[model samples]
Target: MPIKASTGAAYARVEGIGAAIPSRVVDNHEMTQFIETSDEWIQQRTGIVERRWAAEDETVESLSLEAARNALAHAGVEASDIDAVIVSTVSHLIQTPSLAAIVAAKLGTDGAAAFDIAAACAGFSYGLAQADSLVRSGAARRVLVIGAETLSRITDTSDRATAFLFADGAGAAVVGPSDVPSMGPVVWGSDGDQAHVINMNRTWPEAVESGLPSQLTMQGQAVFRWATGFIADAARRTLDAAGLAPEELDLFVPHQANNRITDSMLRHLKLPDTVTVGRTIRHFGNNSAASIPIALDAMIASGEAKSGDTCLIIGFGAGLVYAGQVITIP
Candidate 1:
């Protein structure tokens, strides 16, 4: 027998979602001066057109706080109503106090059990599970989870392969109790086996405060192979865990890692083109943790989803990690 909500007896639901990107935009063609790659090569290889770059003053804390405010406002939930804050990122510039704690203080959401969780690009989905769990266990009434990154900070301008694909941004969502299971059980997995295939350590500064010197390095082809197969497997397992099938889903929100990766995963799942929220990171570049939630905000604002619509959110990133959740809108 599962425990029920205090004032309510029901499952958890996503009340609202919001995303914030920096004002500065970087396009691939502009990479000619910074790297050896051509605009045509970038376009054909990665479906990215442009991405936002953070200004010197724009820190991850600021970006996450802005996203949190928007998510709280959109959800119509008071700051005091939030019981926890989880920030997912690998680019959290600081080493202590936790980025979530700082954002909570800025938002005036005091006393909340704030913390951070890093799963690389799959961070948001991983955090979503944490937030959703908080609601389900009756441990909290509302939880604020944010996925933020500043990949530009560590990107080696000389390394064309990495400098062009990684950028900065943040996105957030609020979860609370619902009248029914508004979201499906998340299915997640890890392949500690494939971790080293995509790593960055060959930069001028050698390395940074933590692992990999903050710069993203990867063998594009190797990642492409791992991504397509891994994501498809996660998707199938997620839908099955939710007790649903591919055709039953109304919308599929996948991590905006790469257009090719997204397409390949979708094809393997046998899902049609109309089911995806694709090409976000392609244009915005891989904002790492922020990718999926940013697309979620866009999908909702565009009215692409409606009441009772089933939306599947999936994320894949470092740790060779991947996860997905099935959600229903109110």
Candidate 2:
């Protein structure tokens, strides 16, 4: 049986958001050494200027731990208060022990249940929805959701499309209870039918065992097609679910996938540039799941978002998935 709409779920609000970027910076000019694309062409398409790269010694566990610590401090919550830790990622350094488990151990919160969620770029959004549910169900009071990835580790510098598009970064957000519905119902969907549109299969054990090149690859145009229509649909559904209208929004924080895709979705949704916050992918490339929250943190700090301000966070990619939620600052 399907759950009916209009159930009175408890309100779940975001307490804080923190982001971490590796100290290493890789700029566009450096791409000339490996790929045929020029800095200008890449920038015109993806809006990436400089992206962070993990040090060779960096591990997914360490990055998530650092990001989680910053978010916990900003929210004034102790690690012990967290009921669970959810990690969203596609680029963990290893395949076992679950990155979330390792993150909990690092934060001294191992008593909390932890798990990993793989929804590709929509990972953080997926994690947020799960966290919200946990809180509303009285199962958890506080949840830590971190989207961390070292995409550069699997990127083939020779693959022009991927080499210039992916980088490394992490973002964490703490979700807890609040008076009003600070975060709205999320509209999410996945079409495994298009699974190959954005693939990361090279790193599979069998592929590695067979001595095949381990790298990340994507069908840029195919993903662009999915992003444009699916994201617009997600935004519309989220607004409708919240019983809100577009004109009431203060900002829109979208996954920093590509400049062209964002522009297309905005056009399709009839939203003006003023309502959207651009992390300027030209500045950080695509951090995948971390992109939306990274942009949200920037919007809040810049005063584009404030207490009582309403906004939307939408992300889509590599699950062949899309998710959108209307969030209000409290």
Best by lDDT: 1
lDDT of 2 by residue, 1-330 (tens): 998554323689988877777788888888778888787888788778777788887766677888899888878888888989999998885778899987887798748999999887899989999999988887788899999888888788788678888978888999988867788888999999988888866656777689876677798888887777767777778878888777777777788888888778677767755575566476677888777776666666777777677887888888589887887753
* Model 1, span 65-180: residue lDDT tens: 88888888889988889999999998886778899988887798858989999799889989989888888777888999999998888778789667778889999999888877
- Per-prediction CA RMSD (Å): 3.3, 3.4
Using TM-score as the measure, the top candidate is 2
Query: How many clashes show up in model 2?
Result: 4
Question: For every model in order, what is the number of clashing pairs?
Answer: 2, 4
Q: Which sections of candidate 1 miss by over 4 Å? A: 1-9, 200-214, 273-276
Off by over 4 Å in 2: 1-9, 203-205
Steric clash pairs (candidate 1): 48-282, 208-213
Error of 1 at 163 (Å): 1.5
